[model samples]
Target: AQSVTQLDSHVSVSEGTPVLLRCNYSSSYSPSLFWYVQHPNKGLQLLLKYTSAATLVKGINGFEAEFKKSETSFHLTKPSAHMSDAAEYFCVVSGSAGQFYFGTGTSLTVIP
Candidate 1:
């Protein structure tokens, strides 16, 4: 079975500081990993995807993650936080049905 586990249900950050959110995944086969960001009342946008080709991947909005096979983890990081970055993030693992299973959701709060 392919599954994704996010270490945090919520993450709070201050404006201009670094942001880190943790995620771990498990899959029977080689996996496809994705990070998606959802703003308020908006649809999800693909942040990045690791398609078994890259160990380290970069995404939109200055976000990035490294796919660690040993640790079974893909953690998202950003150098600086912006108010616009305050949104819900989801860790996803691609499944057999051409679908992606999402984390419960991570709410990012940006303190001014």
Candidate 2:
């Protein structure tokens, strides 16, 4: 079984500052992890993914995440925050059985 937990339900960041969204997962085997962002009334977009190929994965909008097997964590980060970055983020984990587990979600607010 695989499960994902998003430690924060909301995150606030100032424009031009950095952003961080914490996530943790549990699985019997090596799991596939991903981050997706959903803008208001828009579809979800893949932010980054970890599929055993690379420990550090980068995605759109200067976002990135590091897979830490020891800690069972895949936390997302951005160098600078933008107002347009305000959105809902989800942390997902897939187990070997092909079942997907999603975190409740984290609403990010970028303040001017």
Task: Please write out the lDDT profile of model 1 over residues 1-112, one tens digit for every residue.
Answer: 8888999999999999999999999888778899999999999999999977789899999999999999999999999999999999999999887888787778899999
> RMSDs, each prediction?
1.0, 0.8
Q: What number of backbone clashes does candidate 1 have, counting pairs of residues 3 or more apart or in separate chains?
A: 0
Instruction: Give lDDT: candidate 1, residue 104.
Output: 79
Give the clashing pairs for model 2. Answer: none
Top candidate (lDDT) = 2
Candidate 1 to native Cα RMSD, angstroms: 1.0
lDDT of 2 by residue, 1-112 (tens): 7889999999999999999999999999888899999999999899988978889999998999999999999999999999999999999998787778999999999999
Query: Which candidate gets the maximum TM-score versus the true structure?
Result: 2
lDDT values of the candidates?
0.92, 0.94
